[model samples]
Target chain A: MSSKAFKQPWTLRTASSVFVIAWLILAAFPFLWTLWGSFKVELDFFSKADWRNALTGARTMAEHGSSFTGNGYSGAWVQEEFWRAVFNTAIVCFFTVAISLTIGTLGGYALSRSSYRYTFWLLITALIFRAMPPITLVAGYLLPFFEWNLWGILPTTIVVLVAINQPFTLWMLHSFFQKIPKELDESAKVDGCTQFQAFRHVIIPVMWPGVITTGLFSFLLAYNDFAVTSMLLEKENQTMVPKIASFLGTTQTEGNVMFAVAAVVSATAPLFILVMFFQRQIVSGLTQGAVKG
Target chain B: MKHKTFFWFILPTALAMLLFIALPIVSVITQSLFTPHEQVFKTVENCTPFKCTQSTTIDQEATEALREAQPLGRFVGLSIYLDRGHLAFGEVAQAWQSRDGFGDFFNKIGNLPFYRAMAFTLSYTFVVTPLLIILGFMIAVAVNSLHRHLKGLVIFFSLLPMIVSPLIGSLVLFWMVDSRGVLGTGLQWLLSNPDLSLKASTGLTWIMLMVYGVWHSAPFAFVVFYAGLQTLPKDTLESAMIDGATRWQQIRYVVIPHLMPLVTFVALIQLMDNFRVFEPIVGFNAEAHAQSLSWFIFNDLGGETRLLSSASASSVLTILGVAILLSPVLIRTWRDFNSKG
Candidate 1:
């Protein structure tokens, strides 16, 4: 243990605070703004004059009365369309993560354990799939679904969205699962554990951090997936992002302050919760999974 | 016993990948060549002809001599690369390469927006990647000098950008810069001016978006560097320090050379990732800015264009670009793996 920096507490604290605050603001300001924007009224946002209306003061709140509620700070917080977007986004996120992880982990495990002649090729192919742009996949395959009349499968766009994300999930999760030593599996099996049981009891616990990291990433990737979702889903199936984006585009015509309010309401707290809880695992996962790979 | 279980274990992964990831991509490229959507082209054959010629006709009149002429060439096969007059495909495949089944496909890709997208994407990747590595290196060195626990905390903080959904994260930034948001509002008041918008301007927006991309991306770099820093050999660093080397000098000599392998890996992955900068750019463009290749590809999917072929062609181009750019990295990693084995 190299315990060296204890003598210079004040200097270290100041430096760390400066780095942390600046980085946090730059990294998180957009999400914070979304939180605040979701509560604003039409009048405040209308002229683009009140775009700077900070929610810190009571005067702004009083002036923007109908938009601000006690619980949500926005009176019209419970719109059906807003909830529908949230629901739709949740559905997409759910399926995307579920399907991707199951395949990713299984594939990652096989690659890690088996000394196949083409293992490297499989790994590299997975990396390429992960690396290729999502737009390319969506663009290339949008027609196949249309041709199959699978365009009706929640829009041709969603199908593309689901497909594009699969490769990423596979590669990231596979790499994470690979990091656990196989000796643990071998030893567990020798001690009367079957292969599946060894995986369940021995390998899984060790890889939990990786799983969390990968799952969180996949979830974020799916949730934050805007391009494919926006392109694929129509007005009814549009996820939260496109709904918010569409509203932002039509704010003048719609005269709805609550959409921005809705953007804030739907995303802010859940995202913050994810960050606050999974911060450590997510960081390790990123460094190990992406940067060092 | 060994053979049966091994097959079982490997079967699912191989089959899934073959079915899902590999097959679709391979099919996209091949399908583009053979099948032109009936809606978009009359036939893949008549997309553009090799040459043009003038013709004249005279009515069959008594006691009048008439002459007529037309292009005196036979219909060529899809091979024999004829010049398709599109700037997107450029002239590399136009002159001599196109006399095969791949000629029309090459010429078609030559004329599409795919090439411009590739140029734009490659430029974006090239510009942003070095900037990330350099900045991340600086931050990693600065953080490394701090106490261990505190250093870990700082590194984690920097990495939050990686954790958040880019859709939510990037879009939030987009709103924050909007005239009505916090930064926008603060700026407007500070300037005390109406019509002084930050994001509305293209030059500023482009720079700002790049900054956002860097900001979101640098954390991964920082973490990798930090991890490399942790595993770095201490004796070498100590030897440099004992020679009365300054901290910067020690780092430049001892730390950086040690970190090169990690550096190469990070750079290659980032290059691949950045060239595919679809989501963030699309998110930015959704709020109205310049278009990116990904956005164009996405938009092209909806129209009467031959999206599958176009997208496949673009994807193939991107994959090739990535492969070419990162060939050194690939070679190095391969060598490292082989040597270790």
Candidate 2:
């Protein structure tokens, strides 16, 4: 496959190299620009006099006596109390992932082990549930949650997110469990262990890789959610994405766009770290459904 | 697995989906059929020496009590669905009767909120999906040709757009393209029009959003297609080369055919995803120029007045749209399952 016969012509090689380099710039430049601009004052970041001031941070230097200032970060994190949203986000993601994976693992394992036709119907139903946008369901939740005195709370939002996360979590884990052979658990069962005991002894140890991958996705869905978290959670209990959105509504009029800029960077940092650490698992999880189907 | 064991094992998740996903859908339909109770009005006679006058005033307590008694509101049947918000059947009929041509009719229909949203949603979904596929395949092919070490770095950077939250991604791009931001200023300079703003115009806004859509999603397609490329059959490629097939010819005949199934897989997932495009519209603040069904529902649900009935109708309609889009994949899955069984 690596033979000289398969080597590309120089013209084609150059063409592809140029295209890939252009794409890399397009993909990576925005985040880099935003991170850099987030440190500057709003004027320099969105410089009306000159765009180069954004790169040089000229007004940022004039205003704060430094080329780069943490004014936006301080303003967002302290003055606006963006840290509360961060705290709420952490709580939501933690609980949503924990609860979703718990029920999803048990259900997915059952579906994978069973030969019944009902399992097929369940997976198909999950597929349908997964396709419906989360926002559409928000309308139904409002009346009930208001009536039940459950609206505008972290726990309610967490339960809803976990429910919404279930379909994808179940599907991913179902496929992953299918990949693990039936023989191991069967052998344990033959040795006088009950079904639950067989699963506990034989399956749990080998399930970490798949579980971790699925858990990463669950974490992402819970973390990146804006539609459900915005509508269901109270202003005091808002998460990072919705908080950033709220910042836009008020902050833009107050001439404090830098706060939103700083908050966006703050929200994006964890995802950057997640991808950095779990690149392999993320890639595998994405292709898992495609390849298997 | 025995029925008892399986039932116990699946109960928790099944219950969650039922209570949350399935029930909300039913609730939405029910809410959509019912409109909020109208304020109760009481007529009072004011007696004067010269004349008597009658005044009608809203009975706040009575209205509140009525609403409290029946929180589901007054059942309006299908009126809400056919109203100006959801399906806009009346508006469509009016547009059709007064139409000068197909373009004029479509323009009139596009002015309706629901149809306006549908236009953008459908166009965005259709335009972005194939372009991303092509871009993704190109990246996959180019990266596959690269030295092994460079592949890792390129992939790491490539995943960033897709990995970040959509709101954050759009906001990041939105700021960069602000009239005074780098790309915005660059465009102003290049076109020699300092007044040009991407956010101010409908055509540019649509293009900007679709660009964001492709940038955010191409990585998923790239990763999938790259994996497909890894499993390419070397024997077929070698034979094609030996038979004097050019590189382009080999890619056209063999590589593409091999990757066709994966293309369909990526397309199905992207269609589902792009049809629900919501966050980007908010992040870009281009709601004035473009609206999606999700955004329409969000607008109805947000702020001082919840407009629950209107939002619910939109939800039911959006769910129907999703079902239509998803029908092909569901049908394919059913056929595959039937054949296997």
Candidate 3:
């Protein structure tokens, strides 16, 4: 470490430090600023009077006799019923991860275990599906889903999310299951275990690390989904993203901009927490998929 | 495992993909060929002692019935692809025959929906991918250059932008960049021009969208490249130092070649992502000033009048564009698979 430090010249060290500091600031400052401003009244945050009022929280202090208040949170959560979206998002993310992982694990395990040639073509098809945007699928789903009266519910969107998520989940899990030696399964078979028993006993316990990582991604996919949920789900059943988009579309004039701000903060809170807990897994999962696939 | 067992294991996911993913492509292609039926119209004339009166009116009931009877409407083949809102072959020919200047021709082309969205989508994909890659690589190298302990902290913060919902991230940026919001107000003050607004101009809106794109996705690239950096050969670096290589030269000669595969990985993913730059346009409310192919489809399918045919056409075009961009990566993957086998 000492030798490495000495290799860097003073000029180069200063430049890199400057760049790193600037990048951290650029990366973090917007969310931090928005988070702070979410508690302020609209005038203070927006501050047509003076931009400095935003930092100072002048109007927030003036309006509520405090530097910050929960007016926005209350307005969005209680008044606007944004908690419905929170509930919907939870449901969507939960089922999307569960369903995708269940099917993806089986399919991926099969692909990894099999020496058949069609598995290659099957994986290739999944890759192509991954490359296609969800909005394109939404275009097709509109006609059929509407006709079948399946549009606008949580379940339909969940299935769609799981299906769209399959390619990545399958690939990730396939590679992960590949890492477990075939000898483990063969040995289990020699010990009088059926294939399902071999999988249930030998695979599931060892699969959690990869499964959890892939599950986290699936959760993000469902949670972050906007186009499909917006296009498919009904107004009453809108998720957080489409709900926030609706705020952008209609509600600025009612002086309810703070509601949107609070909602944005509320929605982003989980991701912030997710990163805090799973930084290592998330980073490794990302690079593992990229470098390999 | 027996073939039957393997088949059962893979069946559920294959069915899901077939019903949802594969079928959607087929349905989109089918939907694209057909146009919605036109409203039925009738003209009536009455002759009186002094003068004749005539009237034309839409038969709404008949039109509705027609629509109900044939929901997919009449198959127009490739006509929808070449109409004024899409390819606009006729209008383009007129523009060409009129010998309009390139700028004027482009302006006319921009009036076409498909061309306009294509222009933005292509430019956004090309511009954002490279910028994010360079910025991300710089951040990665800088972070890698630091002490190992600070790496975790920096990465935790970096993940925020990339992991946050793109819609939410864009909204956050959009609100901050509103003319009355902090960044916009600060910019106006710094420039001494109160009229400087992101929403008021085309170029500024595009720039803001690109800024949001880089701000959000660059972290993904950074994390990947940073991981790649850890595997850099110690012997090669020590040899470079012994040969009097500067930091820049070491990076250019040794680091980049090693990171090339990772670079392609990032590039492929970024092109696929940036090509579908839909949420930012919606979040920024910049649809009036800018649009993408994905946004075009969204707008058509939305509202009271669902233009299913138009949206499907846009979707097909977008898929084709992705296929074109993705072919190189696909071929490489195929070659790698074959070589390994």
Candidate 4:
């Protein structure tokens, strides 16, 4: 190396730092803006006269005699029954994650442990299914579910979500399980335990962290989904996302956009906190798919 | 593991995938080939010395009887795929015979509902994929260079867009980009044109959708690349420095080659994701200007009419398109497996 080779200059360094920070702000600011706006009155948030009122909540405070108001929240929660959708979402996400992880853990463990050639095909098949848009599958389910009188119910949507989530869950957990050394479970088997017993006594504790990470993803899928839930669930059975969407469709014209706004904030609050706490898992879960692929 | 154990383990998922994923695809294909039976009608006439009356009435009994027998409707045999809503072969042939140039033909064809959605979906996919990759690579590099203490904060915020639901993310941006909102006003001020608005133009709306696409997905790329960067061997980089390779040269030759697999992985994933661009179109209320195949299916399945057959046709086409896009990955995976064996 030449002695005259210059270090990256302080000016360029500062510029790069500013650029990164600016990018982060660009990434995160819109949510914050909407979050703040959700507390204000419609006239202020979507201020026609001046956009600055959205930030300042000027008219909101003037009307309500406070800088912040929960009127939108009340309208969404009480009048719109947004809580129903929230409860439905919780049930759907919980069972979707639970059922998927239960079956997926066993399936993934099997796929990863086996030395047969079918494992490759199984993983490949799952990957292909993972690439498929769930809405397409929703089309298939409609006729049958309708025939079976299973359409438009929370359990129906939950089962469908679990099915839709199975591919990604299998693929993700398969990879995670593959990372665990084969020897631990093999030793358990050699120690006179059956395969299930080996997995239960030896691998369950080691497998939990990976399962949780994968469960987070499954929960995200169930929670964030709009296409399947909206199409599959009856109006009364709608989850938070589809409910918010239905609000936009039905209520947007009625000048009750604030209810939708409040609903969006309520929905986003949990995800915000989830990312804040589980940023590491979310980050790794995202990358693990790429790097391992 | 024993064969019985393996069978037991894979059965549930296999059944689920078979019933939901595989069955749906087959059902959609079958549905595409068939169309719902139309109402049977007959015209009856009554004649008299002074007046004659003719009436066309639906034969409700006959219609219901036929529908009961064939619940899937009448067999159309690929007619639906070739109809006005899908491939538009008739439209294409007419345009070809019109003696117009390619531009005029395209203009006429692009106005067709299915093609219009395809046009936007394809444009969104191609444009968004490259832009996000470049943006992600740049951000990954910058973040990789940042001081360790500040990295966590920046990363925490960066993941929010990717973490949030597509509907919420799009709604947040949609409000901002609305004419009355901050970004739209900011744009108007920048352009010194009070009339400027994203919603008023197709091009601007498309740009806004793509921008949302990039914002939502770039962090996936960034985090992947950042992780890839960590595994870049230090000895090779220092040796490159010793060989007088400039910083740009380092990235172009060494760093890029090291991250090539991850680049391909990200590209493949983003292609699949962007191909199914639905939520943003709905969130932005841009259906007037933009729609994707998924949106096409959603539209068909919803609304008062509930055109199940049409949605099924779109679903089949979408699956075919995904298969085409995914062939490369499958081939690569197969090759990798064979090499390992």
Q: Pick the candidate with the highest TM-score.
A: 2
Q: Per-residue lDDT tens digits of candidate 2, residues A121-173?
A: 99999999999999999999999999999999999999999999999999999
Per prediction, fnat is 0.40, 0.80, 0.80, 0.76
Query: Candidate 3, which segments miss by more than 4 Å at Cα?
Result: A2-6, B41-65
Note the DockQ of each predicted structure: 0.38, 0.84, 0.80, 0.69
Off by over 4 Å in 1: A1-20, A42-52, A55-80, A152-181, A187-207, A254-258, A290-293, B1-3, B34-116, B143-157, B179-201, B232-235, B286-289, B303-309
When only the first chain is scored, the TM-scores of the models are 0.78, 0.98, 0.96, 0.95
Per-residue lDDT over A209-268 for candidate 3, one digit per residue giving the tens place of the 0 to 100 score: 999999999999999999999999999899999998887766647558999999999999
Off by over 4 Å in 4: A1-7, A251-255, B42-54
TM-score of each: 0.77, 0.99, 0.96, 0.96
- lDDT string for model 2 (B1-341, tens) is 88998999999999999999999999999999999999999999999999999999999999999999999999999999999877888889998999999999998988899999999999999999999999999999999999999999999999999988999999999988989888898899899999999999999999999999999999999999999999999999999999999989999999999999999999999999999999999999999999999999999999999999999999999999999999999999999989989
Reference-based lDDT, each prediction: 0.61, 0.94, 0.90, 0.89
Error of 3 at A214 (Å): 0.2
Give the per-residue Cα lDDT of candidate 4 at A75.
92
Question: Model 1: iRMSD?
Answer: 3.8
lDDT of 1 by residue, B240-300 (tens): 7678887568778888998887787788778877776765664555325544566555665
lDDT tens string, model 3, B174-255?
Answer: 9889998988988998999989999999999999999999999999999999999988888897789789988778899999
Which model scores highest in lDDT? 2
The residue-by-residue lDDT of candidate 1 on A1-293, one tens digit each, is 36362233566557755765676666555555555545544444323544444454333476645445333333223543567777887887777667656656766676667665566666666666666665555544455555565543453443444456556665666666666777899998899987778877987778766766777877887777666676566678877776666665554645354555556456656666777788777767666654444
User: Judged by TM-score relative to the true structure, which candidate is superior, 1 or 3?
Assistant: 3
Rank the candidate models, highest lDDT first. Answer: 2, 3, 4, 1
Q: What is the TM-score of chain A in candidate 3?
A: 0.96
Q: Kindly indicate the candidate among 1 and 2 with the higher lDDT.
A: 2
